[model samples]
Structures are given as structure tokens and as C-alpha cells.
Target chain A: MIVSIEKCHHCGACVGSCPKNAIFLNDLVLVFSDECNRCGRCVKLCPVGAITMEAKK
Target chain B: MRKIEKDIVVVGAGPAGSMTAKHAAKKGARVLMIEKRQEIGSPVRCAEGISKHWVEEVGITVNNKWVAREVRGAKIKSPSGHTFLVDEKNAGNEVGWVVDRVLFDKALAADAARAGTEIMVKTSATSLIWENGKIAGVRAQTYGEPIEIRAKCVVGADGYESQVGRWAGIDTSLKADDIDTCYQYRLTGIDYDPDYCEFTLGSAAPGGYVWIFPKDEDTANVGIGVQLSKVKHPADPKMYLDKFIAKRPGLKKGQPLEAVAGAVSICAPLDSVSMDNLVLVGDAARMIDPITGGGISIGCIAGMCAGKVLAKGVKANDLSMNTLQEYETMWRDRLENKQWRNWMAKEKLTTLSDETLDKIVHTFSQYGVEKLSVQDLLAVIKRHHPELVKEFEELI
Candidate 1:
């Protein structure tokens, strides 16, 4: 998942919904690690839609 | 890396973290609380409304420094504008106060400091340290400097996205059905009444409700929460809230001072909040009320319960799940029924159509609520719409 920093609220909502526990809020920055399975749950749970799929390679 | 040692290390300096640290420290346990933020209560992520009764119960002395408005009651409005007024005088619940969240959080942290908790700001827990096949301490960073914290017990008071609990192998994850994504704006020049907090139900907020919590006569925190499963588009909560504000003549001219976004979990009480040397408190433990989307009071109460057991475990030199089970028992005895029952009620409320919402509110408006509970609501509907009680009876 890719987080649009400008739109991100840093609210940590995505961090909780990530089934793999791949996301963590680093102060204002939202980090998505390799552990993320691209479940797309965080994209939907994000209040401002800050997170989105990184477009399948 | 510098090494710090303590009996307990609480991650996240929110109300829950402060309460746990305070209670445990007062009991003679050396406690340390770490916060990622430079300030204790910066980046407000809550509705800032807390019921008054739990404050005294948990031994929090109210100070005018944090209170913004003391409300007598709440105004629950249906989609069609039908109103059910419930105040402290009649309702089984106590009245509440709208607070300046930043100040309230700081005051709580200050109180914990007074009780002898060592607080470190701009210090973040990066991961948990495991030693000898058991829970040990935390790996943290102080500013840019890496530091290691060695503790006998770890307390996860982190909020909705509690990483500590997950790292401890606890399932604190929320599915779309259990979480509500929220968006809020601190608006000025509104028609909101300061004496009563307002909540509008129905399609305006899909699975959740739109709330107007006043800061004063001219300003208020206007927000909306929607079930994640019900969100069909990007920024659905903000969309719904803006639509509601546009339709309201009273709020049409309101101007926003700040925008805040958050999420609330309205799930059933977790299967466990403690194990071995680790304990979870507050939102990290899914203590939020399902029907109200409120967690401040509930979190504080659980923090106290967890604190007592946390200290005892340290003193006894037993941080095993066996010793920490006292915390689980205390919280379950006090809060299990309410959280479980409200989760059921929320499920029923979410499936309700706007028309049914109008009916429920209209019926409730006639008598007003004596107590806020699923059973009480079903009883009232049983007296009026006998058929309505059937759908809800299955919940009980």
C-alpha cells in the first residue's frame, strides 16, 4: 500500500486494520512494510483514503 | 544505546497509559511511560467528550483547566428530526463534559508524574525485547538516538492501531464490520447549543452517528463516523458530514478552524487483554463502547484495574499470565456485560433502515430514555411497536 502523505491524517486507523500488522505510524509518516499482503483493507478503512494499492507490478 | 530499567514500561502516553502508570507507581512499582509525540496530547484524535461519573470512580479530580462545557444531557435526533432527550436526572447514565483534549491529556500525565512515573517525551517504542523465551522489555528510540528499555512487564496502552498488542501475539485487529472511520472538523459560528451535546442518527452516518460536541457558544467539534463496510467511496465519512452540514440551515455558514480524522472500534470485548508479562489497556484492548463510539472513561477504568495487577505481579516476582489474570477478572467483572450487550445492539442498529430509525426515535421521544441500554430500548418498543421487539429480542 502507498500512503499519500499529504492526505494522510496519521491517525493510525490503517495500522489496526492491517491483518499482517505491516503498517505503523512513524510520527507523521505512515510506513507500509513488505509484510503487507496488499489486502486493500487499509485503503478502505482509511478515513481520507490516504492508503492505496501500489499498482500490481 | 543507553539502557533504562524499570518494573513496567507503558507505551503511549494517552489517558490509559497515564492511568496505568499512575496507579502502578503509587503502589511502589517503578513505572516509565514513553510517548512518540513531543507533547503529551498533541494531534488530538478524539471527540473529547467523557462522562463525569467514571472520573470520580477512577479517582480523577476534575479541573477547570480542561473542561470546556459541562452538558446536562444529550439530544438524539433521528433522520426525520425526531428528538429523544436524555439528561443525567432521568437517564441511568451520568452527564458529561466536553473537554480540551490536549489539556486533559496533559493533566492526566501530570498526575501520573506526581505519583512517581518517569515520563519520556519524543521517545518511541520500536519493538519488544524477548529474553529466555519470555517477554522482557522494549527496544525504543529517543529522538534519533536508539535506546533499550529493560522492564519486568510491558503495558500496551496504545490506541486503535496498537502495535504492542499485536507484537505480543494478541489479535487486536478490527475487520470492516467492527471499525468506524471518522472525520471531524472544529467549526466556528455554529447554531449548536452548548448546554447539550447533539447526535443525529440514520443515513447521515450509515453505521455510526453524526455528533456535535460544543467547545463554547461559537465553536464546536462537528464530526461523523461511518462503518468501514458501508463506505462505498473514498472519504465517505467526510462526504457524509459535509452533506449533513450543507443541509442544515444552522450549520450552513459554519467555517472550519481545523480538520481531524480518526477511527473507533466498536467490537466485542477481546478474548484476552493480558498474558505473561504483557498487558493491554484502553483502545489497545478494544474497550470502546459500541453504541456510543466512546472509550475515554472505559479505558481509564480498565487502566486502573490493569495497574493494580501489574504492580502486584512485579512485587511477587511473577509476571506470568497466572499473576496477571487478576487484571482480566477485574475488568471483565466491571465491563464485560456492557461492552458485549452494546456490540449486539450496534449490530441491530446498523441494519436498520432510515424509516425504522424514524420510528425508533419517534417512540423514544414520547417517553424519553430512563436508561441507555439495549434491554431498556427493547422494552420501550415492546410497549409501542410489539413487532419491533421481535427483531431485537433475538439479540438479548
Candidate 2:
């Protein structure tokens, strides 16, 4: 559930999408943290197609 | 490498996450908040406009450090240059405020930290840790090291760029028509009224509006929003804004201090925002007003609800799908129902022709219908256009 800064517009859409309330826009970057539960709601709901899911390294 | 455990863990550190943490911590829950950025608020993305009364409603403290200017009312201008003033009396007493968004967001995070929530910046969550087919916590990376977080309840506050909720399977997708592309600039040397929020609606931004929210007497946050489906000719927002400014006698000489581009979801609330042990708040849940494109007010309200419900679920040791249902029900009761009505109206409005819009606005003004309800407006439209009644009937 890592965020892609380039795609993000800071609309605050994903901030409310998290059940755990895990999304926040910090300056120019949207940050996701340890509270995320892989709900994938934010990934599917981004208005400008800013969010995506990548496999763990 | 780090391993930590807590009663409630909130992700993203944005308004929703911070608010949730604040409330949950106020209730005596051990709260942990994480962010991928070094600072809480930076690189401003919003139009920086917010309703004035939001402070009292969301129980937020008023801080002069973030507020750029206090607005008295909203003045809406039609396509043909016709204007209508929604004065403070007709509108709300204090309509809104133009803010320094970065400062505002940092204040929120600071509030949460002051409430006893541990905030970790420059941290990222990679995936959810599952246990018995339900989310147990998150696997995250701080700096370059791996860390595992285990908590009874987890929250996603990650913003429009959220993947945490999607990973949990809530179907947070938006249609092209349901979303808006926005562009904004922090302009200085602009001589505009600092007490009024101005909106120019119609051809300038089909299916959306252009706004000038004052930051001060000499500066303002100027922006425009357009529905993705109505975007033709690939026009840039800043270009349109500059052209508009050039035409205005007062703003032709202003200097742009910064540029911002973003998008907003004017869609209705989602069918669900809760999973077994996870909850989606703010933009992830799609709890935004379709007409105004405002979410901070609703997001904070929803966060309060999520925080309270989640705390109860954790206390009962019942952070399961059934238990988390309370979060969704509470949110709907508080805001989703109203947001859905607005979305329906937005759908009807988007399909309207320019002439029809002009006629409607003219008729409303002529009828002296200064105080209008969304439901009443939709009813009026349906009565006159029966053939299109089906489109707007749901609004009633």
C-alpha cells in the first residue's frame, strides 16, 4: 500500500477511505504507514488514479 | 527493524488519521500514527478554503498560524456575467476561511501528538499482516528497515493516493464523471476582497467551478475544478485562471507564489468502509459532498465516529467484520446519506445544457428564491422538465 507521489494530487480522498484512518498528505507527499490493513479501498477509489499497490520487496 | 504493539494504529497521518488518533487517545487508547514524510504538512495541495464554523463542529482548536483570512460569504457568478450574492445572513454567518493548508495539517498532527499519540514520520506501510484470514496489523518500512506492527484495530488515512483500503478490499474506485481535476496557485500582489469567497461557475469549468479564496488582502488561493468527463481540448487549469485574471482589472498584475494541481472525488459514499479489523475514513470512504467538493468537515466528523466506534470494538475484543459494521452505520448516519443526495443532484447537473442552466438560475433568482434547499431545487427542476424528471427525481 505504498503511495506514488507523482500520481497524488493531495485531494484528501484516501485520507477518509482508510478504515483505520491511515492515509495523510504530508507536504507534497501522501504517506501510508503501519496502521494500514491492505483494505485496497484507497487504491480503487483515487479520483485521479494516484494510488497503487506494489508487492513487498 | 522495529516491532511495536498498540490498541489502535492509524495510518497516513492526514486529517482523518490525526483526528482519529486524537479522539482514540482522548479515550485512553494507546495510539500510533505513521507518515511517509518528514514534516506533517508541506507541499500544499488543497484550495485552502474551509468553512468557518468547522472549528467548533469538529472540536478543533482555532489557530491563527494557519488561517489566512476569514470569509464572510460566497458570491456566485453565472456564465453570462449575471451575479448573485449569498450574503452572510442568507448564507451562514461565517461562510469559510482561506488557510495555509500545510500549517493547518501540521496543527492537526500536532494536536494528535499532544493527545498522547506517537507519530512516526518518514515511514511507509508495505502490506497488511494477516492472521486467520483477517487483518491483524501492518508490515511497514521505516527509513530502509523492515518493521512489523500488531494492533487490535487499524485505520487507513492515506488520502486520495490510498492503497491501504484497496488492499483490504473495499472497492474505492470512482468513475470519470464522479471525479474532478483541480489546479490551484498561491498568488501574491492580488488586490481582492479578503472577506468574500468568489465562485465562477459555467463554461469556465463545466461540471465544476473556479474559486478565489483569499489568504490575505494581498494574497489568495486561486483555483479551478472540472469534471474529468467534461474536460475537452485538454485545457490546463492554470492557463484558464491566468486568462481570467488578465481579464479582471484587479488581478492582471498579481504574481504567483506557488502552483498546485490535484483531483477530488465528488462521488457519493461507498457501500462499505469497514472490513474484519480495518476501517476506511476520509477520502478512502468517499464521504465528500458532490457539489462543493468539500471533505475536511465531513472527514473530521467521520473520523470522530470511527474513533469512538473503533475504541468500543477494541475494548470488547471484537474487532471482527460484524463488530466493525458499527463504523459504517455510524458514518452513514452522520454524513453519507446527505452526501448521496448531493451526488444525485450533481449527476443531473452535469448532464444539463448551458441554456438550461442559465434558465434555471434566472428562474430561481426571479422567483426570489434566495434561500434554497437542494431537495427543493431538484423538485423545481423535475416539475418543469418532466421528461428529465426521472434523472432528478431521486433527489427528492
Candidate 3:
């Protein structure tokens, strides 16, 4: 998952919505760690449409 | 590689930051306000309703340009459809206008710039600058370029995810119950009372409420805020909102124009909002109304207080905790009691069953009580529903 820094208002709606708790905010940056299962819960919960699932690298 | 200096640096050019910069610059303090987004207010996240009283109090004139609609009152509906309507004049600060948030935010930032405050957009503050264990400034990315801004005083107005507060060691984390996951749709072609804002309570929005704030004769911001802690199963506020719209015939007729989602902090103000040369304002300080989730007016009020205190501190060459504490004291004096009361009301409100909510609405309607206060609510319960008085006695 990728969070567009420009679109994110840093509300952290995605942080709490992540069931795996893989999403965390560090200094206003939304970081999705290795634990993320791509459930895409954060994407639907994000109010600003800042989060998107990127093809796995 | 660029380094800039100012007397005060304000992060986030939302209402709070602009107001803070405006006041500080008006007081002759050199202020720089920055916004991470390219525009001052884009991808609007608010319900956009603000009281006319505070708008005037903050010295901003309410004109037609940004005032989308002026509501005569608010309507509260229970799950069973029992309704109570409060007149605007009697509703105190909760009743007023639904604004164009983008224009309103731009106007505030313009005011700050007019007051000689330097403004920057597309600048993201990634970290705080600490000098000798005292807060000094921010390290930021401006237009994808690294830059450092050092200031005598720093104001963190960075909305709900306030990293500045966390970096400054002010615990900004919220309990699950203290937050609302919200989703809103700006719907046009809707049939709604243009003169009234409407709220629906009960299972439609568990632990929170659904609101229809009319923006025009045929358009409204239809939104729902669900308490994160109260959500079960899927735990998605959007799903709840979809269900709400699907059930309402009037809403079902409306065409969605834009969608917005965000989180709101519905907690009491932080225990402490200031440290050495650092202060937190707006949503960063959790200035949102616990029940209503309205923060524009409160955020502006707090911003003004911060600006005044920051200016004083800058003039005295004392940006220490002692001086910045005045901002905290001023905000608490102005808003703390009301915030705490609302938080208590929210705590109790979340526990009520839909049946009880229907009964409460029915009771209020029977007693001709539309606007609710702790005292008024207790009085009504004591008179008509005495059995519940013990449960709510603590509110009195």
C-alpha cells in the first residue's frame, strides 16, 4: 500500500482501520510495514483517497 | 539545502495555522505558515458548518461568497424517526452556516499573508528541530526539495495526526473510543430542507451520528461518523454510511458529487499543549467537540490564543515552557469546561440503546426541549423519566 503524501491530511483514519496494525504514522508519514496483508481496509477507510495498493515490488 | 528563519513557524495552513500566523504577524512577529498540500483547502474533509458567532468573534465577516447556506436551525432525528428541531437563536453556537471550506481556508491564509506573514504551500514538515533540548523549528520538504526552517517558537496545527506533538513528547495518541471514522458525500439533486441541518442518531451511526448539512437548495454534505471502538465485524464507517443512504428515500434520490473521508479526535483537550518554545493548536490539541466533532471555531479561538502568547513570548525573548504555558491556560479558560462536559455526554451517549435513544427523543419532543444541555437533559429526565436520573445524575 502507498499513501500519497500530498493527498493525505494525516488524519490517521487508516492507522486505526488497519486490522493487522501494520499501518503506522511516523512524523506524519503513513508507513505500511511488512506485516500488511493487503486487506485494503485502509484504502476504503481513508477519507482523502490517499492510500492505494501498489503492485508488489 | 535551503535554510530559512523566522520568529514563529506554523505547520499546517488550515484555519488554525492561518489564524495563528495572522494574529502573530499582526502583533509584529515575523511568522511563516506552511501547508503540505498545494492548495490551502482541497479534498475538503469537514462538514463545513460553523457558527456565525465565532466567525464574527474572530473578526471575520460572514459574507455570501463562502457562506454556502445559512441554516435557521438544526433537526435531530432518532432511529425511530422521532424528531426534535431547535431554532438557531436558541441553539447557541451549534447553529449557523455551512461554508465552502476551500474558500474559507483560502481567505484565512490570505488574511495571514496580508498581515505580513510569509506563506508556503506544498511544504511538508517531516520532523521537528530541537536545539539544546528545546524546540526550535521544523525540517521540511518544500516542493520535493529539502529545507530547514528555524524559528524562535513553533506552533503545531497539523490536524489529527499531529506528529509535531509526538516529536515534542506531548502524547497525542487517542483511545479508540475517542476517535470517529467519518465518510461524507457531497450530494446534489437532493430534496432537503435548505434552512435546517439534520442529524440522525442510533444504530444508523453507532457511537456517533449521521448528519445532513445542506449546502444549497438541492445539495448537501451527507455524512456519517462512527466511533472506531464501537464498530463490530467489518468495522467500516463507509459501509455504515452506504447502508444509511440506501435506507433513506430522499438520500437515495440524490446523486453523489464528491466523496470525502477522515478521522476526528473526539477527546478532551490534551493534558498539556505547550512545552519549551512549542505549542499545539487545533485538532493537534484535540480541540474538537466530543459529541458534535466540530472544531473550526474552537481551533480558531485556540489559534488566536497561541498567536497572542507566541507574540508575547517572542517580544520577551522567552520562548520557554513558562511563557508558552499562557497559551494553554488561555485556551483552557476559554474552552476546557465545555469540552470536558461534551466528552462526558459523548461517553454516556455511546452506551445508550436505540430504544433508549428513541425514548429520549420522544421525551425531548414531548417537553418541547430541542436544544440539549447537561442541565436541561437532566431536568427533563428527572421530571419525565425519573428512573434514568440516577444514571445521568453525574452530569449535573
- The candidate that wins on lDDT is 1
lDDT of 1 by residue, B255-297 (tens): 9989999888999999998888999999999999999999999
Query: Taking the true A–B contacts (Cα pairs closer than 8 Å), what share appears in each candidate?
Result: 0.69, 0.11, 0.22
- Flag regions of model 1 displaced more than 4 Å: B394-396
User: How do the residues B1-396 of candidate 3 rate in per-residue lDDT, one tens digit apiece?
Assistant: 799999999999999999999989998899999898888988588999887778777767666878899899889899999998777545877678999999999999888899899998989898888878877799999989999999998899988766677778887777778878888899999877889999999999989999999999999999999887776643357778888888888888999998777889898767998888888999888899998999999999999999888888889999897788888889999999999988988998899999988888888777876445777767877888887667777888
DockQ of each: 0.76, 0.11, 0.24
For residue B396, model 3's alpha carbon misses the true position, in angstroms, by 1.3
* Each model's backbone clash number: 0, 55, 1
Give the 10-residue window scoring lowest on summed lDDT in candidate 1 chain B: B86-95
What TM-score does chain A of each model score against the native chain A? 0.90, 0.81, 0.90
- The CA lDDT at B197 in model 1 is 88
